[model samples]
Target: MKSRSASKITLTSYDDLLGGVATLEDVREVAIDELHSFTDHPFKVKDDEEMKELVESVKAQGILTALLVRPLKKGGYEIISGHRRKHAAELAGLKQVPVIVREMDKDSAVQAMVDSNLQRENILPSEKAFAYRMKMEAVKHQGVSGANSAKKVGKENKDSARQVYRYIRLTYLMNTLLKAVDENIIKLQIGVELSYLSIIEQEMVEEVHDSTGKYPSLEQAKQLRKHREEKSLTKEVIRLLIIGEPKKKTSITFKQDDIKKYFPPDYDEQKMRSIICQLLEEWSNQNH
Candidate 1:
């Protein structure tokens, strides 16, 4: 890392630092204020265990990858992706972290953040949903403002307004489910399916959070959802199920004496049983 001098850093070319960036090995540390974290990235589910492991690896391997950033209008640079990596670096006592400095406008900055994190092979479903929604919102902000507010590519901004509209639909989910979606436990398609239920049904889904400790299996969620569709369930009922009950399950049983009441007085003991068995065997053979 170079000195804590802004004069040394400049947005020269995106590709030159595309895979390579200046490492601040000489600079032991940079003040946290010089870096601005991106407000747009969506993966916020913190796994403390995983973070601890990340800190350990960073301690051993050093920061193998450089964080992405763009110069802010004010002074510092805003992170695009690699917030977690930055954080882990900090926890590992990194004084200076490698970064790619680029020039981009508001919409492009937001879009770049989403696209960078999302193109990974094992992208989580909830992460996709949230990223899609975030990108849609960013576009909406751009459209509402003006063309100048968005960063220009070669052509006029051509992203479909309707496509952006579809992604924004995800925000309608109740908070519990949205968090579940963010954590990647719930599928985005399943979230869309759940969204079709009434507000009361949505509340019922929310109520179930305490009982399940996680989202229900797709089949179980389907059953609750089916009942909601038939209008046989109300908000109160959904709430009750979601809240759950403490009742114990009981087993069915019958004594031998109680079973005798159904027998006829004319019924034979051994011979009748043998004849019935023969008949049942014949019926089974015929059906096969």
Candidate 2:
């Protein structure tokens, strides 16, 4: 009889491990502490409702799919994907997870990581920004011919090359402004225009917005970018740009008592305002 030796086994590539006849045997149960996150992972792991649901699922049925990882030179494995899953498993009090080990280069690891995470339905703007930027750099490092890495990434992301560049530009924005982008306080087009400004210029815009409770309109962002190009973007100029002449409000005002009958008793001022704005926007769209 011959004894099988684990030490003599070697994996040539991820495809061979995952696609070959060794698929079932390639997966192993590893201690959760043995896995490390990918360096500079762009996607966020939030404990929001989605994460809560994942944790519940993991607790109820266990992790259905194995995490994809690569063995590190020193020891343990670096996670190429399943960061959120790992986090959820932790919250579910899981000490071990199933993983598939793959031998891959840095570029391959990065491409795999980006491709896997980009399939998520609710990725934030900031996540997309950094992910696109990282994938673009990895594509270049992989010796991809030509300078159109954005086009390659765009094809995978279902966007145009120009749109990919625009999203990547968001990486240049300050943290506060970038947070605003994530919160939808600043639209994508406006965020792209603002990304052209220097860090200090972006800070100036953030300060003005914080102080005045206002955001830059598309026209205002364009003007700000133009001023920045001419090297005339100062605090005062930014202030005026963001706080451009406020249009006069109509003199007519509806008293709370008068409008209260039209709304539900549970409706608050913010909810009423939101409904009004939504109706107005729909009406404007229909008319136009």
Candidate 3:
């Protein structure tokens, strides 16, 4: 999708401007040092092999696309798009890189920021969770609400409303569990279930995972949810429920010496046994 330029609104904030026209038309060389990262950027800028390739590309071909940025209230530009390109340029040791300065308000900027980044091929579940939530709020701030809000954001991201909400649920998870959800250690459904758990209960579940090496099954997660009361859901109980019920004992044996003391010395072995059974039957009859 084509990016919107800041020039649609007032462009007076810029200390440096090529023109007061389309952002696409007014590209300028911004000092790599001056461009700050997008605030609360959900996407990660990792130094992986993809970045190595981008660095080499920047070193050789220069920045192909101008970064989209808006002037911050503090006096520097906040990057709206082309975060990877900016990082690559920095790695390439370039003093200045091309940028398209635009006038974007915070809500529009946040929506645009997420819209731009969601175009990436591989976004972690956590990233989607937070990004969808941020964009949904931005949508809400713009007077979009109810089902329409999810549809507006989800339509942009190629997801259904329910799928968007499912992704957003991961944000409630503690970082450790959320990371596991990202890593696929916890299945998406299970993660959603775990999200409903209190942070302390979730921590207990994490402890169970760490101490017992048991990942929570869907049923176990449901068990956690069903027995959510703290009085009922102790750590050991969590462990037992997660690990499943213990096996039942099939047979019990008693040593002959242990039973021998209860019998009379005058009675023969067969008589002793018969008498014991008779006495047990009599006792059971009395009790019953």
* CA lDDT of every candidate: 0.61, 0.84, 0.83
Q: Residue 110 in candidate 2 has what lDDT?
A: 86
The clash number for model 2 is 0
TM-score for each model:
0.55, 0.77, 0.78
RMSD of candidate 1 to the true fold?
8.3
lDDT of 2 by residue, 182-273 (tens): 99999999999999999988888888988999889999999999999999989999888787666888787888898788799999999988
By TM-score, who's the top model here? Answer: 3
TM-score of candidate 3 on Cα atoms, chains taken together:
0.78
lDDT of 1 by residue, 1-288 (tens): 444443343333233324344444422223455787777456663658888998998898766555668878788878886677788888899767767666777776877787666545555545655666666556657674333323221022243444333334456677667767757677665666576677667776666666556455555556567777787777555544444566789986666456455566666567556765788899999999
What lDDT score goes with residue 249 in model 3? 81
lDDT of 2: 0.84
Query: What does candidate 3's lDDT look like per residue over 118-213, in tens digits?
Result: 878888999999999999999999999988999988887899999998898899999999999999999988998889888998999999899878
Please report, as a residue range, the 10-residue window in candidate 3 with the lowest summed lDDT: 9-18
Q: What TM-score does candidate 2 get on C-alpha atoms?
A: 0.77
| Clash pairs (backbone) in predicted model 1 | 1-23, 1-24, 1-25, 29-95, 207-242, 208-242
The C-alpha stretches of model 3 lying farther than 4 A from their native spots are: 1-24, 229-231, 248-251, 254-288
Superior candidate under lDDT, 2 versus 3: 2
In lDDT terms, how accurate is model 3? 0.83
Per-prediction CA RMSD (Å)? 8.3, 13.2, 9.5
- The candidate maximizing lDDT is 2
